[model samples]
Target chain A: MTKKKIEKQLSLPFRNAFQMSLRSLKIRFGRSIIVTMSILLGIAFLMSVFSSNAFTNALIEKGPEALRATMQQNSQELRTRSIWLVSLSLLVCVVGIVNAMLMSVTERSREIGTMKCLGALDRFVMELFLLESLAHGLLGSIAGAIIGIFAITIVFLLQHGRLAISVFPAGALLKYSLVSIILGTTLAVIGALYPAYVSARMEPAEAMRREV
Target chain B: MPKEAIVRTIGLKKTYMLGKIPLPVLKGIDLEILKGEYISIMGPSGSGKTTLFNMIGGLDKPTEGKVYIDEVDVAQLDAYELAWLRCRKIGYIFQTFNLIPVMTALENIMLPMIFAGLSTDEAMEKARQLLVTVGLGERIHHKPFELSGGQQQRVAIARALANDPAIILADEPTGNLDLRTGKEIIQLLKQMNREKKVSVITATHDLKMLDVSDRVVWVRDGLIERVEDRANLDIKIGEVEGEEAG
Candidate 1:
């Protein structure tokens, strides 16, 4: 085959991604579902925290100085707790992603080795993992966005139908979406780095060997 | 550092030190594999045939030596270059037929092309042609688990052929199949070698597996015990490499 044919053959994209994801999914079937769920839970927690803050903001507005002082103190207490929970949840998810990626790459060491032996470049291999990470993160983010909004809406009713029509969540939605995207990309890259590195480094012979 | 050898090794040594005491996997080995040559490496368990393969294949670095594949000293390459060489040149087949389970047989075969950076359309077209060539034209959409062991091995062989590599290294392509299936797989591999003219290297404990190999190399205790041409294979019975029956 010509150089062009081989190059054309090796540069397949969506199929590669789909294959990798499927393999990754089976290799860590239980963990992937858990990861998706964990992401959902984290986003839900954020939504609850935001709506609670808004609720407290409304309650504090209705009172006199003495009640206002108490509400202010309570509000401060709520902020501290919410911030702590959010931070903890984020930490847990990060660790989870790291673990998921680690397990994924480790299990597929032979496969990665095979690819390299067949003449896959490091950047392309890196991109494979990076792409998988992106897909997972994006899928999670999309799911999280839809779930988060619903969560926000449901909790908003705790204020006794004060919000009659759906308010345009301009700044808040945009900010959260940006934040999630950033988090997703960061997590995806961080997750795939070590594994991709090991894969890119493997020699073809060792990669093809039978364990027994 | 020999000029004519596509793969050359110089005093290759790999040692695993456990708490200061050293356990050597490959003691000191030197050899060469020229282009388009079919070779089989045979040894019992723990004989280090696998380790030797690892070092030569560039899947792992040698502790104290140089390995040159396709004129580039693999031992001298940084990570990026090594990866590039692998993607563009080597095709590996594992004993387990490690096709990605979620993907169809066609997708599994398409993996190497994807790694080489082919656009999806072009990659798919090539993948289709390769799959059909391997006689799995109708099984393109079937996942790995959905296929039989022999079929999976065929898909793997097709995948190895996907990159049109300089060498095809199979650890034990038919290890998991029945004897009949094993023979069929060997025929497939031989057909690949003849048609594609790609070099082939296999590592197997199955004496039955060496019939089609152009050369059979026996490795014991991390050393090349012997290398025999096809005509001389009948005169030699390989020594046990590692595991012994009680």
Candidate 2:
């Protein structure tokens, strides 16, 4: 019934994972706060960057028929512009991933020590960090995706429906959102590992001596 | 005597490698402690009391010899087994009363139980009983930083007892307390020893403590120089400090 032996007796990795995460979150509330702030900042940046992307998309989609009247003069230039804008959105998301991961790691030093001392294995410690990063990434990217979709709609109305970009690729948008979220979390786990290891390998006496 | 020897250390040593050459801290030392005994290990700073305490508590291992707790060689245990041993059989209380500052007194008491996987209802019941035993039943909701030093120590005492460990190893438990609070903590330890039949081992430089201990062991330069009963505690020969040897 003691806390240390519960995992061995219960076979409850899922419950333990959550308990570890909550314990980590409790100990590193300040770090959690900072991680949340970074996530919000990254998502906000994604939204702003992609809002303009939606506008460009709308511009490219519209006026295609009009340009068809003079196809040789217009088609190639518009195609190049569309590729350039899509690349810009992709670049923003990559930057966002890197930014979020670094901030999350910097805030969670003592927490890793606490977990390791409590009998967490090497892989368990890694998974806790990974889980935290995944949670932030999932929440952030979903919010970003929904905002990007809404931003496209807003951009379409703002331009008075003149842009011809397909307004509704709901399935592609949903699938891409899920992919980016997973990718963002994977990047966060990588960024979090070095810090978590530095924190985990701390000598127990040293950690016990630490005031915090 | 064999069954009573809950902790035994033989020729234990530890050396810190400062830049290449090892700086020895604990020299070859041998000592045995019995179950349910109230003993105090006393010495001045740099006498390696903390190092020895950490070693016996399974938080660290000696480089040279062996340490056994309850017939199980701690030095032979792997990381997971060592942790389990520490969490289940040995309870440690520190000088700073290292209860998590964010947690309430009751929460700190229950953490070991929760970690050990007791059901919420059972853990709470045990925690409440311990807090009452430590005389902290009313302050259960107060966070560590919010409580006085004595109160915080009480919470730590409760935490140490939460899992019902056999040996309560305290390293300078009252180091940070004032005289009044410190003496009160000593009294609490004595009561726990008598009533709960829990073995208590404390390391302190406070000479006032040797008066109260059933066995007073003097440690100097990483080795035990003497083991004395309360009557023999009056002798001055080979004691840690000439000034404090009563």
Candidate 3:
């Protein structure tokens, strides 16, 4: 075949990979939802903590002269404790996403074999898993950010009544949500890498035999 | 010169490592298949017929020797090149009807074409045509779980034809079906081999294969015991099956 023809043929495999990812998510919708929930909760946790920290920092920056020093001391302590706790929760969530993706890869060995036999390249196989996880990450992160905003708002309302609204800066919450989205996507990609590699390197014959 | 054989294997050999023991699968298989010929590799279990199919289809590498498809040495091709060749030149069907369960019959049929780089519209058109050819047009929207064994196999056949491959390799294509369904599947394969001029190489122990194959290659213990043309098939296939059963 001509070079142009080869390029033309290369065009559809990515589209097919994307479609395969969608089909997989739909077929395993329950598992997908669970994975999404893990990511959402993890990101939401981080966002809420960060938003609260931002609120404390803002208080120290603009609080009454008499209260600023004590508030600064309190903010330092809260930041240190929350950072360690948030980091631990995030680690657990990453591990959970990795475990979920690994299971998904194992369950689809035969489907992977069939795709490989049909001429899917290793990269295409990798792309399918990565895209699936990425979709979950984007969806979960967005949802988590929305929920985190409400969570931060609720915590502040309960703690400080109507004055809590003034202390919870809109700009700070947006920043926290943005940071959580990025972290969620990064964690998801990291978790998916090993599973994608496992799926891509599977021998088609062996994979099919496993299913049979 | 005459046209080169569509598939040729020279001294093809494969061995597996089972702990410290070595198990030979294909012991120096040398074979050639011509275009449009319907050939069957007949053997009992452990005869390495499936291994031979995998070699020719580029699904596995041989420990020794070479596989040449359309006169191109398969070993010399990189992974990308092998993938490209598999996509555009060969199709495979399995006994278990390895259709993606999550996909509808139409989507399964369109898969190979998608890998071959056809646009969605073009792939869908070809897939629709192939489904009709395999008599699964009415069931195109059904998932594999919803289809009968025969219908699922038909979907697999349609998927195999999606790329319009020069050769189709079927590994125990009817092994999972009933007698009547097996016979029907064989007939469909034969029809495609004849009308489309697509070479077909099937590994099967089914006695009915003796009726449809242009040539039969009997493999024993990872070696080709004999190759016989249909016109010169002196042994009674049914008697052979009965003897094996006994």
Q: Rank the candidates by DockQ, best first.
A: 3, 1, 2
- Candidates' C-alpha lDDT: 0.70, 0.69, 0.82
lDDT of 1 by residue, A43-88 (tens): 5455445545544555566545675688788887877887896677
Q: Write the per-residue lDDT of candidate 2 for residues A93-121, one digit (tens) a residue.
A: 56656665665664445444443344445
Write the candidate numbers in order of decreasing lDDT.
3, 1, 2
Q: Stretches of candidate 2 above 4 Å error?
A: A1-30, A43-133, A144-172, A190-194, A197-203, A209-212, B1-3, B234-246
The DockQ values of the predictions, listed in order, are 0.40, 0.22, 0.43
In model 3, the runs with Cα more than 4 Å from the true position are A1-8, A13-20, A59-76, A210-212, B1-4, B232-234, B241-246
Best by TM-score: 3
lDDT by residue for model 2 over B118-140, one digit each (tens)?
77688789998898898888888
Docking class of 1: acceptable
TM-score of 1: 0.79
In order, the candidates keep a fraction of the true contacts of 0.61, 0.16, 0.57
> What is the descending TM-score order?
3, 1, 2
Best by DockQ: 3
Best by lDDT: 3
> Each model's TM-score?
0.79, 0.79, 0.89
RMSD (Å) per prediction? 5.4, 5.2, 3.4
Scored by lDDT, model 3 comes in at: 0.82
